[model samples]
Target: MGFPRWSRLGSDLRRAPGRVRARVTTARGRGGPSRRRSRTSHADPPRGGSCRPGRVGSRPHLRRHPRGHRGGHLLSTARSGDSGGECPLHRAAGARDISRCATSPPRHREAGGVRSLVRQPSRAFVSVRRFIAFGVAIVVIFSTLTARLYDLEIVRGDYYHQLSEQNRIVRLPVPAERGGIVDRNGYVLARNIPGFAISVIPVDLSRTREDELSQRLAALLDLPSDAIGDVIRAQRIRNPYEPVRISKTPVPREIALVVTERAELFPGVRVDPESIRFYVDGTLYAPVIGYTGPITEQELAKLKDSGYLPDDDVGRTGIEDVYEQFLRGTYGWREIERDAAQREIKTLALQRATVGNTVSLTIDDRLQKLLDAELRKGVDEDKFTQAVGVAINPQNGEILAMVSIPGYDNNMFARGISTAELAALNADDRHPLVNKAIGDRYPAGSTFKMVTGLSALSAGTATRDTVVNVSASSFSVSGTTFYDWRAHGSLDFVHGFAHSSDIYFYTLAAGTPFAPNVHGVGPDAIAKYARMLGFGAPTGIDLPGEDGGIMPDPQWKIATFDEPWTIGNTYQEAIGQGFVAVTPLQLLNAYASVANGGTLWQPHLLKQVTDAAGKTLPIPQWTSQKLDMTQENLRLIREAARRVVTIGHAYMPNLKIPIAGKTGTAEFGASAGKDSAGRNKLGFHNWFVSFVPQADNTDPTAQIAMAIFTYDSSKSLCELCLNPAVGMTQRILEQYLGPNK
Candidate 1:
């Protein structure tokens, strides 16, 4: 058999309910709860005038049609003599009809018998039957319905009561204001401004006036006409009464326009107060301080479980992100009573918001501004991509100045920038958002030698008098050659470091036939020493995103590149190349350690914290650890660093303050050998790192230690205050330690 068509089967099932009822009733007991024979089947209305069950007025006409001639219609014509004009109704039912008419009892004769009965039985019997049937139906239905009602009202009362309560009361999320951000001196960095957002109470609006209301709102809010329609359409899919934002964070002009002209057209439109971010000082501390914007979708998802909302502003970078918890105050809310239409009637309960605490940094505004001015001057003269400058007090490891060039105005984020402005900022090649002092890592150049000299001395690798001959400026190891800026004939550690003799350090690193372990003392030793001086890790400064510069080892080489560490790699790194890298801040810290007599102090950028009431809060002070070094070894390294500034090396002169320093001309890209003047046009990192007034009987401690890292892609030294040891040292001593103090 062919597969059954479900459409035809469905129709047949719908039409056959009478048969179904008869079958089901017989299968069950008729004596118990007699089921009503409800007509479930539906069929198309019969052709012409068929006797439908509805009206008794049309029944006589239907009865006459079966009697043929009485209605001039044929019932059956098979036995009729006239084939063409024969009446089928007459042939099929005329005889039976005549017999029924002849033998059937008359209604009048029955009525006549009814009158002879005592007490008028006809009227009494009819009334009695109807009354008994009606009473039985009423009792059965009422009893069944009453029992069901009892079950629902009492047994399942708690379950239904909770459901009803949920339907009546809606728990809404209250938007909390974000905390304010401030500088060390209580200057505001980021803040909230009260603003308004337009919303729609969709269910309150009439469907007939929806189009007109949408158009009027579009004009008032400066929104696309379709936007209003879309909001209404979306609400229709969810709860129509729930409030949905039409224009989030609408401008003041937009809000005013709506209130003025289109007030009557927008019954559902309302202004909701919101917060906007602000930044007072624009480019002064842009990179170090960072900015804040709207929370992104991806960030929102990550913070959704933490109870963040769509409008909440979070820290995007720098200290804003670093101390987000402390900088972002707690959010508060209110319990409000709302009408049936979800319009807030009044606030039943309110909670005052707590603002975030202000942060005080070790950075001095005066010193920072001066440092920025100096860096800007350097950048303009050199025409470099970027520049950074850092100054610190060696006695306490306090960062006095930190400056980065090519700063940006944070005010762009204050007013909630459009998509185009944000894209332009991010797309700039100069990377205005970058914090160069801590974020960028460059080779510390020759300045890193102080760490090598100190670490090797402490590690028993090389001594102050460990002499190595240098016939030429360049040195060779394992057939690979490395060269210095100038040649130095026969020199000790002091002379070698003062002249930056690459061959001298290379010879000690290559390990002469005299000392087998001496050659093991190449870049690996330098890197080890570098880490010991806090070169390869964060200086523990209270800044965000401090790049721990790379210091490669044998394990690092194998893990990162699946290659063996080579002697040439070590030799290149010994000269602060190959895989060696360090931030300017790290270089300064290393020299400061040597200046403070082998003490490694953690660089601190925060001096103290306080409450709004002016009560001082307990905070950790600066601390340091001393390296185990003999006084003789420290004296040798100290003299070597000091001579670089005072003695005639690279035509640089000694300072009036008797400062000890080193000038490193590291060949980085293609121009490492040239001076800071950019004459070679390749890239070389010029470094001058030093300490003041070598420790002695008169002044056992150096007051300040400073390092200058200036990169010249053009290879011109004149633009960088070439050999700035004398000038930089004089300026620092004059400001901090001179008679002006």
Candidate 2:
């Protein structure tokens, strides 16, 4: 397009600086309407200006200014706009000041262009920086994670792997068969019987399903549901994989079949074959054989390392306990792989168990049964509260038959006794559990007269023919009157023992005015003989809980009763009273010593121990020691014992074999004098200690010694009338000796 006259004039003004300068100077000097209009036209748009499409090329009308001031003014105006305005270059360039366009320096204009260029950056550079920063952060985070992964997956891998494997693997125990207990005659005393046992696997059931499983088991086993739940819950806490036994006693065949057939109905339940303890003739041999039960917490603490688990059955008493190590076999185990639900996947390894050894006792079953029968008969007939009978081979100290009446069946303990049943057995006044033959202690009564007589002779206080004048029925000692059961005019030492004369023994033990020439043997000699005869000490039998009878001396009396020894005590002790006491076994063994020519044998019960393969094990030999007494004195006592059985009380009037024995009526309880009803209420513990074949008999090997002790809580009976112990003894002798030969 052709340039207009005004455009040409603007161009000519820009090119002709003198004419433009003269015009700007005239406008400034006048300060008139034209200069005010020029100032208003170049002023900045309202702070923030918006661009218009039609006004793109529009410019404010220019006011002329002097060329010298134009550069300075343009520079100041651009800087002020740039300081606070959003678009400083746009605002300053769009002003209608022609002087700025004509006079702004090239360097200042270049600076404005540079500021506009810096306000915005290219898209590519921004994207590249962000990518670099994000990459660095990702590297840092991943590096830390890799280190932790290395520690967990490589360095400590084996330790964590072991813990994980434990959850998947389980150990199942294979119990070994316990040994059998047999008597000397090859008769079994205790043995094992195979039975079915029900068990629960806790890990296989959920909490809500446990009650359903428990209910099913209770109905099948005839047990309390709560009891089943309790057992299962307890096993869950200990180890969910291990099975807890519900019952081991023999279950009904029908029940077993039902459980086996309906196995799917009872989840986590199992029926397996197991062994239960059985005692043959349990009641007859309970005292000797004892019983077995589950191992207790205290026993588990001691036996855990020894392969005993909490569910193991252990011997509780008698021979079973004494030989536990020999009877309890070695247990075995199998390592099994299991799923999370405790289902067995496969067996990894197995260890076979060894069977326990066999225990053989010295007891003869035939003789034991006979003794038991006779003792039971006597106890029932005499109304005795307790009774005991013991038989031993005097030659070797081997116990033949030991019987304690009112015995119980040991199978109750083996098959799991109820709390109430156990309480009743324990609450019984007569202790049926005790082996009374060796356990009960009683006053020796006249049975100990042999000790005093033998002591007097050994101390050189009297001879077989030495006489004591017993004209008076009673004697005085230290102002205490002592009486004999009856008065004998006179008696020698041999007759004194045979007659059981209290005064003769009293005069021999304490001093006598009628026999002043012969001194008494005194309490010292008596106690010495009592000890030499195995009193005041255990018999060292291979049994538990043996009671050693008391043999008192001055020192023992002072220590026990805190009292000085008086002459009356000596007088009473001379006839087996006062402080003298003896177990039936001890009394029998003592008499056996005399019968066997003064050799006291150490009693034992175990005859041998053999392995399951029938190989015998070496055991300690039987021990015996000779008594410190002359054979002559022993012969005299034996002769006196024979006379007592034959002549003293007529205890064995019809016996044919040369039998010798003594009868004792020991006073017990302060009410022995009279009862509340003033009846003759004296209570006596009757005793009969004996040996067959008198001391003079050539056949010493055929001799057998026995002791019988009986006591009743009511009504005293004479030794000659209701001495059932003696009666039982006679029958035993007759049976063993073939009707007394």
Best by TM-score: 2
- Distance from true location, Cα of 592 in model 1, Å: 2.8
TM-scores, each model vs. reference: 0.68, 0.77
TM-score result, candidate 1: 0.68
Residue-level lDDT tens digits of model 2 in 110-224: 2321111112344677899999999999999999999988888899888888977986886778889889999888899988887677788888778889888888887766568
lDDT of 2 at 1: 13
lDDT of 2: 0.73
Clashing pairs in 2: none
Error of 2 at 610 (Å): 0.9
**Which segments of candidate 2 are over 4 A away from where they belong?**
1-149, 157-171, 209-230, 246-267, 476-479, 513-517, 670-680, 694-703, 717-722, 739-741
Per-residue CA lDDT of candidate 1, range 1-741, in tens?
122243543343344332222111111122332222224333322222121222112222233342224655533222212232213332445433421211111221122111111122355678999999999999999999998888889989888888765454445555555445554455565566656666777777777877887888777655677878888878866878767776544345456565546668687666666665555556777776676766789999998887778766677776567656655655566666666655567766767666665556666665566666655666687565566667777777877667676667776664545566778878987667777777778876666666666656766777877776666666456687666555567777788787776666655554533234454365566666677778778888766788998888888889999999987776666667778788878888877777766788888766655554565666766678776666677767777776665563533443345667666655556544534564555566666676665433223277666666555533543333354433544565555554565
Candidate 1 residue spans exceeding 4 A from truth: 1-271, 296-307, 395-397, 461-471, 475-479, 511-520, 540-544, 558-567, 604-607, 611-625, 630-639, 648-661, 670-681, 690-708, 711-713, 716-741
